[model samples]
Target: MNYIKNMEQEKALFLANEVTVQAGQIVSKTLAQNPHVSITLFAFGKGEEISSHDSSGDAMVLVLEGTGQFTVDGSEYVLGVGESLIMPAKKPHAVFAKEAFKMLLTVVFPSAT
Candidate 1:
């Protein structure tokens, strides 16, 4: 993602109902981005998952529909629609769709300078 350094910032409004969930697939849409943070919307089909990984920046997941199982550093947490969780920086994390689910992910990074 590139910074719109010299131009006026761009804004986009998204309706959660418009994000579609496909069978046996995971889809994502990046809504906003900048040097410091990124906001992404994701739809995961039943039994779909993201394998274990760690990020340098802190990340947050807000469940918009259905349920998800998040294993953060070996601790399991089940989050449903309207629930949220914060995964700390440098921690091992994995995501699994309890069924079909949708989430809004926000990752915040420290200043590069």
Candidate 2:
């Protein structure tokens, strides 16, 4: 079974180029998704944002290009190219793009009882 989709197999590729930033919008490419984990790529236009929300999984983000602002539990952080951050599960978090940027987001969910 293919655990990953929307990408080529056995190829060398840059993650940042997987998605393109569109003016006034956010674009996402989900490479893998299951109950245990989710891997996604995102490109955000300048001033685009994702409103605050909580997740049931711990989310990690790696900046592939440009800059992004992350707010976790009311604290703010600005990340540039190659930077990464983790947002703990159950804590509120939000993401904003100060300029056009691309990122890889991996979320690991808790196991079911």
Candidate maximizing lDDT: 2
- Backbone N/Cα/C clashes per model: 0, 0
Compared with the true structure, what per-residue lDDT tens digits does model 2 show for residues 1-113? 78999999999999998999999999999999999999999999999999999999999999999999999999999999999999999999999999999999999999999
Note the residue pairs that clash in candidate 1: none
In order, the Cα lDDT scores of the candidates are: 0.86, 0.97
Cα lDDT tens digits, model 1, 1-113, are 45432223564644456478998999888867777887888899999999999987899999999999999999999999889999998999999988999998999988897
Candidate 2 error regions (>4 Å): none
The TM-score between candidate 2 and the true structure equals 0.98
